[model samples]
Target chain A: MFVRLSAALLAMAVLATAGSANAQSLTGSGKLLLTGGVSQIEGAAGGGLTPWAVIGGYGSARQIGANVYATDVNTTDFDIRSTGVLIGLYDRVELSYSRQAFNTQDVGTALGLGQNYTINQDTLGIKVKVLGDAVLDQDRWWPQVSVGAQFKKNDKAALVTALGARRGKDTDYYISATKLYLARGILLNGTLRSTRANQYGILGFGGMDDKRHTQFEGSAAWLINRKLAIGAEVRTKPDNLAIAKEGAAFDVFAAYAASKNISLTIAYADLGHVVTRRQTGLYASLQVGF
Target chain B: MTFIALALLLAAAPVPGQPGAATTPVIATDGKLFAEFGGREGLVKIVDDMFVNVDADPRINTFFEPAKREQTKARLVEQFCVVLGGGCTYTGKDMKAAHKNLGIQKADFNALVENLQKAMDKNGVPFSAQNKLLAALAPQHRDVVEKPAY
Candidate 1:
């Protein structure tokens, strides 16, 4: 299914460019460097841990843009790998798809599941820009705002339910606001999300109860120059599962745009407790945009 | 962490159009920003280089021709000089009046900004100083851009 979807998207991209007068100029007058934020873990354009209001890719208001990214997060007891693709339309709307694989290395053996047990989940996301502009409207006090949703489904439905998860599928809805203070070279974003997803939906959704909770995610970045930005993010998660205690996630990251098309992000991430206690390690991602 | 705290502090810091920075477009009362921009002579060179880039840029070149380029450059320099508190008066028309029939879109506006950034880079202007100028000029889009009628 993933292969078919990827092939269809690739065909669409090729056809769109072929139909344009100049294929190379399809993304004409690209956005300012680093304005289109990097891909988030759930595939939205944002910081490492949370989504921002900015769209993904370098396409300006007049063009269609797309990007493909792969992220790897390695912790003390687990390893997570995510890969995704996204498309942005006229700087107004965004659609994304990501596949996450969570490997429970030694923790799986401890829990009697097995060593190196893996849980796979697929996330489909859509975001719309509702108001304001983060970059151009520097004079305004209000930040750019966007509303988005991520629909996630885990492949191991039976396993997740046996582990106290109520469901193997759910949706996370969020609203994000971002502002870039050009003069001070600072970018700030805040997001409010309503969800029942446990461990970002990999371990399934709603273990304790069926009620959704509103959580907060925030990011603060300092733009060192056109190519580099360093930031930190804090994301509050719902402790829905009864088996293991969950806590807030934190990361300090640096993103570097090698050129108009490629960006690299690296971070030290503390995921609190994925399933085991004190899961923290290195997170790195690479993205290519057009 | 300390960085997040500092960022939050700066986020609440006084920006332009506030009491700390003055309400009007004349933001740099200390002449510090103007010096970083190389003053009037520096503005002239920057504007000239910007025009050269605009002329070469196919996306926005249709709005500017060689015949009116010189006059436009002079007006831009004077306007920028005034904005930077270089002690000059803008003799040119207002933003809306000047761009009345140009049919400028957001893309065009951004393209112009990109060209200006390149020109500033060529002049060795510091990034921070360049952003200060951009912040002051960013509000002009409200008057300059005219949405196309569908």
Candidate 2:
């Protein structure tokens, strides 16, 4: 029921803004192309791996915007799929919800579980702009900043706890700063995240170490044109699980805005060791919005 | 590793507002960018077309309604020319003075920028070149916009 309602709202936002002759209407799509970053893996508006400071959709100040996205990531031994909906209000506050499914594939059978065992998790997020303008304030050295939090819950509570996870539910907090060098066609973002999620909470939060750790994530992108951008992102992760050792994540991506209402992102992602072996694979995402 | 290299390369690019560089708003000094903008004649056409867009744009048309069209166009052309290193002089009032009491908001400023981008696109200006001009003008928001987005 909630999914249907969110879909209806997203469709309405697109239809209402699309037919308008003037983009400056009260609920108009006035922002420039590609300024609103694409949806991240966890459903925030940003790069494929990390969230940026920009709002989710094209709607500028005094307007409302929303989007729906589907993302898929396939590694040699696993498959991860995520889908979500997001809403940006007056470009000041953003709310989002996403669901992720992690397929363990043959690795599950090796661990005495059935093949293709899946762990499903849901995340709810909110972000508030703190200061500056990432797009319009191109002249200032200071970047736009935002604070956000994501509350997550995994369905496989018993299995994850058996695998040395402390809890199946937790919250991750982060602050992100994003800036665009308009003249040089460059965009840079830095985020500091406090989290205890092991394997992004798929293996559940905090294993032997039950304390949250601060981590850094960064992205640098070059705008090839108005509709196209190529970039790279690096995200540091915590090794809180005693069962597995983890490493930082890295990806190089290309995002293309086919039109005002749709965008596609493709990337080569290296997630380091998931559980047993080093995992690397292809990541793709599709976003549709106002 | 490749991501780090790419990021380093991008960060090493020339930054604006460096202390030693000449304080002028002009980005290019070699006249190459002026040629890319098709020189003074091209600027005239871009300014003219931008006004056409502005007039039809209800969001910001009211702001332009009080100004003299020809005078504003000429001043804009001169300002653009100076920014592009065309060696032109801008004789009009400073951005703060000209926009005083106009009640310009962030949305209105962005509207004008969109119109200008359309004009430049219509005039066949390269996207990167258009951004250079915009980057030079972007700082003027501090003076031109009276109402904050917050």
Please list the C-alpha lDDT of all candidates, in the order they appear. Answer: 0.85, 0.85
With a 3 Å backbone cut-off (N, CA, C), the pairs that clash in candidate 2 are none
**Residue B6 alpha-carbon offset, candidate 1, angstroms:** 27
Number of clashing pairs per prediction, in order: 0, 0
Instruction: Write one digit per residue (lDDT tens) for candidate 2, span A201-259.
Output: 99999888898888889999999988899999999999888888888899999999997
* lDDT of candidate 1 over A1-290, digit per residue (tens): 44754674687578667876867755653577888899999999999999998988777666778888889999999999988888887788888998899999988899888999899999999999867779877776878878899999999989998889999999999888899998898999999898998899998999889898888999999988778999999999999888978999999999999987899999999999777788899999999876
True contacts kept of each: 0.50, 0.54
Please provide, for model 1 over B64-116, each residue's C-alpha lDDT reduced to its tens digit, 9 standing for 90 to 100.
Answer: 86788779999999989998999998888778778888778777888899899
Misplaced by over 4 Å in model 1 are A1-8, A14-26, B1-24, B148-150
Candidate 1 deviation (Cα RMSD): 5.6
Q: Model 1 reaches what TM-score against the true structure?
A: 0.90
